[model samples]
Target chain A: MIEFDNVSLRLSAFALHEVSLTIMAGDYYFIMGPSGAGKTILLEALAGLHIPDEGRILLKGEDITGIPPEMRKIGLVYQDYSLFPHMTVEKNIGFGLRMQGLHHPERKKRVDTLMKKLGVGHLAQRAPLTLSGGEMQRVAIARALAIEPEILLLDEPLSALDPIMRDFFVDELRELHREQGLTIVQVTHERHEALNLGTRMALIRDGRLEQEGAIDDVFVRPRTRTAAEFMGFENIIPGIVSDAGGPDCRFDTGTVSFSCSTKAIKGENGAVCIRADDISVREKTDPGTDRDNTYRGKIVAVNPSGPMVRIDVDIGLNIVMVMSRKTFESRHLKKGSEIVLTVSPDDIYIISTGTPDTTCS
Target chain B: MTSRIKPDLCLISFALVGSTLVILILLALLNITATQLSDIPFLLQVAQDSRVTDSILLTFTAGLNAVIILVLLGTPLAYVLARTHSRFNNIIESIIDIPLVLPHTVAGIMIYLLFMQRGLIGAPLKDVGFIFEDAYPGIVAAMLFVALPFYVDTAREGFEKVPLHLENVARTLGATRFRAFSLVVFPLSIRHILNGCILAWGRAISEFAAVIMIAYYPMVISTLIYYRFTTGGIKESTAIAFLMILASFSVFVLLRLVTRYVGRYDDRV
Candidate 1:
């Protein structure tokens, strides 16, 4: 396991503020954040590029914070692929082996194995400058893996590729992780990439790590208002908790109350975080008995969101719901249409309970 | 009619002004060659003359040696300047460019004060039997002093073009700082370094006032041409001048070709 104990570093105009995280062995860990969020800085810190000003970095329980990158047994790949333009594909792949003092024959064998594995063996004699983007990316990855690092740090590895190439590399990365059993830390801002590949992930904002946990927990249940927004929680309704004696509780929003299952206690001031995809909309009909957390509302707006359609509904409070284009078209929904919105009790996540300024709205 | 003619007039004037230097140089070279082509035997004799050939060879050799030293020592400084951003580095960059802006005579005088016998650096070297008074060392010192900025500035630009992440990746791949530089950064910047060396060498060879100030004997082409012009009149100096122009142009063209060939891979990406 790798651990960062309250690491703080100050770069020009940006700083990572007492950020700490633990990445376990064999975990595909992703560091996700917005641009200039210090995600790359944390990855670089793990790669030993930047030394923390006030903390310790431990690798397998050893304090390797002060060690140089060459001795860290870690590999880093950048978004641009940073292949050695002076060397051919084969030579680029063999560079790390040569640095590690491997004999020529053994190095050649290992390079050939990695090249074939990464599907760039045919371009071995060609210079990196002559290779395609995908080809160069594979060569760079092969070069890093030739050293057989214990941990590989990738800085937006797929952000440079086109959509199709990104899909291809996503699968390639998944297979590489499974085959090598290498602990990988990837930095990205794309939520789907993180959800698809990461077993565990961290969310960062303004240089501070807001939350970190298993992918499902962090995505489904964020712990802060900022984390909820970043994790795509579109509905954050401030309210007070009541009826907290059982597995479910009532969230009284002063205007309306929502039945939610949460760990929050009675009289706690918090907000119910709900993903846009969780709230479903249907045509309003006669009042039904299954109206636990359902409400009749009017569609205030209909906005197309790529393959999904976002409908803003006003049920005494503004709430956004997203559904697939097919489902939206089947419902024939539009602005001013009357609809009923229902959210499961399990989908409502209580966040920032009892925090100051979290007044009921 | 005026609107249509305005752009045409601007284009013609711009083209004329831009081509003026090329036109003047071509005319001068043609005039010199035309005057000398009729006297092939005399031209051949000038080429065969020991004084002319030896002076030309010495100039080329000294310029080449100066460039070699600059490449060896200036490369690291150039790399450092390229990778670092600070007030101190800015000061160092301005100092490196001092030779570029200084008058050639002032540069010569500076070199003379620093490296002349009984001077600051020359005094200690003189005690160790390394004299710089009217010697080969003095000629090279003057050349190096004047050509320092050409090599360093060009090499620094080349180093700057290479992304720093390449070296970082190399370090993570188990290479030390030096290895990363030597294997990754140096090879990528070789074309720039070579171009810088060529430019410095050209500047060194063409130097006149500086070399004359420090070392007038063991004449370089420029100094030899000056001495011949002062003592032997126009006819004698013209032949050497034509030869020197022809030789320098040929070498300059050859080096440019080599640089182009080395940098052919640059545009592939």
Candidate 2:
């Protein structure tokens, strides 16, 4: 188990601040953020590459905050494998064991088994420069693991590979994770990779950790407005409270009204989020006329991305709702066409927008 | 751009530059006298001379010794300069190139003043039974002073380019800082060190003035060549010059092969 308590790291242009995290034994955790959000810094802090200024880091209940990186039993795999180009794959993989002065035959036997398992057994005789990127990455991992580290850390391991090769490499990593049950702390900018690999994810934003939970829990429901937006919730419709005294309050957007779930915590200026799949688009503006959450919107644009198309509908309030391509195609919605959008009260997720829409705006 | 030279101008410049370089080579090759060319076979009589063999051995040993000392001490210093960002690092780096620019004769005078028997360091050393004025130490020092820029500059470049991330990965692989440098940094920079050795050896062999000051008694091949040219005449000097060319040529071939082997790993770019 690795635990970070109130860790804060200040570097050149960025900081990883007050980040407290727990990596349970055998858990696969991912740290994800946008560029400059200090994902890499967080990984470095955990690996003992950078010591946190304000906090303590404990590995297996022992404070390892001051320990040198070499003494820490943590494996790190980077995008560039950092293989010793002068040494053969066998020699590179055997380096750690050799440092420990493991007998020649014993070290060779261990290296051979690892080599076969990684399926690079035949290439052991070759120089690292002669190997492919994927092969080099495997050798790097093998070399790190030859010491049998207590935990493993990867920093954008697949970012260096091209699209086609990335899939195969990701699969290889998954197989290794399953077989070893090694505690992992992987940092990446790619969301899909985090979702696929992480049993749970810690979301780092700006300098601080925003939130962390099981993958499905965070995906379906996020605590903060920023978290929801980052997780790909595009429907942000504006509305306010009207019947505030009642058990359920109705908020009016002037153009449209919503039976808001955000009524309990009252605010004049706020943003509401409804997931793309949650909002249903209808051809005729007939059903649910008297309902609270109904708006007539013009389908501004339709973007087709693989199996799903997201429709941007203008609801006259400078707000847009995104819906699936299948739903848009079935309904036959086109640009410059009129459509009606409806949302359930439970689905009307509204919170204060602290930061501007830098991505969308 | 107007600065772009026209094809006709470029052709003329290229031809002019080629002619100038070829003429310089031609001049050096043509400097020997007709009598010297005729007496070359008679120099074979001098080739069997003990002085000739002793001079070659001394020159080769000193050059090799200078290179060995440079590698032993200079590589680690280069690595530190490569990795450190302190103000002193830049100052030290700029100072490293001073020997290449300073007149070798001036360096020789400086060494003579500092290390002669009555001079500052040599006075105490003489009490300890150490000799510096006309010995192998002085010869090796002279060669080292002139030959070091090649080693430091090349090795520093090698260390600078080996991305710091590689060393970090080595550390994470459970190797200590010392182990990382030994297992990762040293091996990766071997080619650059090879480049340094070749340049240093080439510089050392071609050195004249500094060697002329420090150890005139125990003659190196360069001093021997100078002696023969002034005393025994041009015939003997050209023959020794020819032998130096042959010796340097084979090492040059070896360097080319090694560079090609390294170039395969990292593309020329």
Candidate 3:
């Protein structure tokens, strides 16, 4: 396990403010944040590149805070691959082994094994500059893995590739993790990539850890407005709990009321985060749904984005819902169309409660 | 057709004006070669002359030694300057470039004051039997002083062209800072380093005012050519000048060919 105990760092215009996180052994942890959010700084800190000014970094319960990167036994791969242009593919892959003083025969064997495993054996003699983007990425990964690091740190690894290549490498990385049982820490801004690959994840904003937990908990139940916004929670309704005695509560937004499940007391001020895909939309004439958290609204906008369509409905309050293009086309939805929207009580997560003045608005 | 031909004519005129200096240099070299070739026996006699051969050899050896010292000392400074960004580094960069703008005579005077016998550095060294007065050390000092900026600036440019992340990756791969630089940064910047050495050696060998100010004896080719011109008229000096030119040209051509071969993988980086 790796643990970051309230780490704080200041680098020129950017600063990480007492951020803390943990990654267990064999866990694929993804760090997600917006651009300039200090995600890469946190990853580099874990890799021993940046020494923290305020806290200790523990590796497997041992304090390794002041250790240098070379002795940390952690490998870092950048998005650009950063393969040495002076070396050929084989040499680049074997660079780590050579650095560790491995003998010729053993080094060559390890390099050959990694090259064949990563499917770049045929390009061993070719220089990095001559390789394709995918080829260079594999070579970089192989080079990192040749060290047999306890944890591999990747900085936006798939962001540099095209969609097709990204999917291919995502599977490659998954298999590598499973076959080798290697702990991986990836930093990216893409939410889907994190959801697809991460067992645990953390969301950072403005150099602070907004939320971190198991993948299902962080994604399905974001703990703050910023975390919810980043996790694609399109409908964040701030309200005061009007009736809260049991697992179910009536949340009043002054304009619209929602029955959501929460553990807060009555008169608590908080917000309910609901994913766009969780809210179901239907024509007003099509009935058979219960009226627990249902509302009548008019479609305000329809945006078709490749395979998905985003619809904005104004039900006294604006709520966004995403559906498949086929579903949208079959429903014949358009602007100014009357529609019924239903959201399950379990799908709504309450957050930012207890502090009345600091409630999200 | 007329409109297209007008631009072509304008371009040709521009090319002709721009190539005037090149044309003049070629014309001068050809004129000297043609004149010297007509008197084959006299040219052969000049080539066999001990003074001409010694001066040429001295010039090359001193210039080469100065260049080697510059590479050893200037490379670290160049790499640091390339990778660092600060107000102090900017000040240091400006100081390194001072030699480039100084007049050769002024530079010669500066070298004379610093390394002359009983001078600041020369006085201490003189106590140890290392004299800089009309000696080989003085010749090399003058050459090194004038040629430092050429090597530092060119090598710095080369180091700047290499991305920093490559070295960072190497460090993570279990290499220390020095190992990372030697394995990754040095090989990538070799082409620029060689080019810098060539430029610095050329500058060192061509330096005349400075070498003469400190060491007129053990004459370099430049000093010998100047001396020959002062005592023996244009005809006598021309022979030594022709031989020096032939030797310098041959070395430069060979160095350029080697540089081309070494820099074949330059564009890939």
Docking class of 2: acceptable
lDDT of 2 by residue, A1-361 (tens): 8888999888756787899988898878888877778888888888888888899999889999999998886888877877776678999888878877799999999999999988889998998887888888889889888989878898888888888888888788888888998988888877788778788888899989888878777766676766777777776655544444434555566776678654433434455677777777654635664544767788777778787777777886644556666776777678888877777777776654443232110
TM-score of chain B of each: 0.93, 0.85, 0.94
TM-score of model 3 (CA atoms): 0.91
DockQ, each predicted model: 0.64, 0.43, 0.54
Considering TM-score, which of the candidate structures 2 and 3 is the better prediction for this target? 3
By lDDT, the candidates rank as 3, 1, 2
By DockQ, the better pick of 2 and 3 is: 3
Candidate 1, residues A1-361, lDDT tens digits: the string is: 9999999999878899988899999999999988999999999999888999999999999999999999997988998999887788998899889999999999999999898988999999997888888988898899889999989999999988999999999999999999999999999999889899999999999999999999989998888888788788889998888557557778888887888877657778889988888888644563534534888899899999899998899899999999999988888778898888888788888885684332232
Stretches of model 3 off by over 4 angstroms after superposition: A237-243, A265-270, A283-291, A357-361, B1-17, B27-42, B266-269
What is candidate 1's lDDT per residue for B81-132, written digit by digit as tens? Answer: 9987776998899999999999999998988888888789999999999988
Q: What is the per-residue lDDT of model 3 for residues B25-128, given as tens digits with 9 covering 90 to 100?
A: 99999999998999989989989999899999999999999999999999999999998777699899889988899998898899989988779999999999
Candidate 3 per-residue lDDT over residues A163-232, each given as its tens digit: 9999988998899899989999999999988888999999999899999999888888888888888988
Q: Flag regions of model 1 displaced more than 4 Å.
A: A237-257, A265-270, A283-291, A305-307, A353-361, B1-16, B38-41, B266-269
Distance from true position, residue A174, model 2, in Å?
4.0
The DockQ-based CAPRI class assigned to model 1 is medium
